[model samples]
Target: MENILIPLMDNELSPRFDLAPEVLIISITRETSAMGTLSERVINFETPSAEAMYRLVMAENIQTIICAGMEKEVYEFLKRKGIKVLDNVCGPVDPILEAYLAGHLSSGQNYF
Candidate 1:
């Protein structure tokens, strides 16, 4: 199973990563050519903070992050931690997650 995190603003991907108020964490399992969701949960922050987000990511053991935009430092931090960062993705949460499961999502792709 792979643990993925997506920063959210309302129902869509947050335009700015550090400013996102909520984050969705999902666990998916891939078998053969099929993918299935194992679990999903949302974490709401009292205030947006990159440090807090990073702590959650570490605590949750997130393997991948699907987000719209993030600072260079934050991106580098995740990379250094061996986490996959799919930046610049824009779309509603459902479609974006579906596309990712299908292996069709890419950075800088706008689905909105």
Candidate 2:
């Protein structure tokens, strides 16, 4: 099973699903690895550093993460730990992520 952690901003939702900042929604499935789907959503407390982020993933056992941006320190930390970081994403996360899951979006080489 593959797990995806997505960091989201508050305004992305149009009042219906108001969420807090520095929170991540996790998605997963039994088949096809639905990392960003709505089946599962896990909210985090803070935006951790690279090393701390790796530790969080280890604690949660997550494999991937989707976010708008990240610090270089965190990037290298996750890379060394073999955790895939998908950064530089735009708002209204659900759509962008859906596209990614559908094979339309690429994480790009900037993260590596």
Candidate 3:
């Protein structure tokens, strides 16, 4: 079982991390092959802080993050907590999640 988080801009991925106005979360299980939606939340920030986002990820028990252009400090912090951050992923939210479910999502790449 794993929970994945994406910083979203409309239905597409945000162009950059730490600047997304909203977020989408998915809950997935290896045995069941379903992309279950856990929640979607607005990032409450005039300027979204990486630290604030990290706290939300931790609180949500997010195992993986599919996002674009994350800062090194934030990336390292998530890794230190054993969370997988797939940075630089670009495209529509649905296809990206689908690619992940099919096991081919990657950082700095488009897998659709």
Number of the top TM-score candidate: 1
Predictions in order: lDDT = 0.91, 0.57, 0.78
Q: Which stretches of candidate 1 lie above 4 Å from their native place?
A: 31-35
Candidate 2 lDDT tens digits, 1-112: 5677665556242111112344465555554454332456646545334445455567877788766666677678777888777666556766765676676765531221
How would you order the candidates by TM-score, starting with the best?
Answer: 1, 3, 2
Clashing pairs in 3: none
> Candidate 1 on 1-112: residue-level lDDT in tens?
8999999999899998888999999988766566464689999999889889989999999999999999999999899999999999998999898888878998988888
TM-score of each: 0.93, 0.67, 0.81
Q: Model 2 reaches what TM-score against the true structure?
A: 0.67
TM-score, predicted candidate 3 vs. hidden true structure: 0.81
Q: Which pairs of residues collide in candidate 1?
A: none
lDDT of 3 by residue, 65-93 (tens): 99988888878888999998899888898
Candidate 2 lowest-lDDT run of ten: 11-20
> Model 3 misses residue 18 by how many Å?
1.3
All candidates: CA RMSD in angstroms? 1.3, 6.6, 2.9
Estimate candidate 3's alpha-carbon lDDT, on a 0 to 1 scale: 0.78
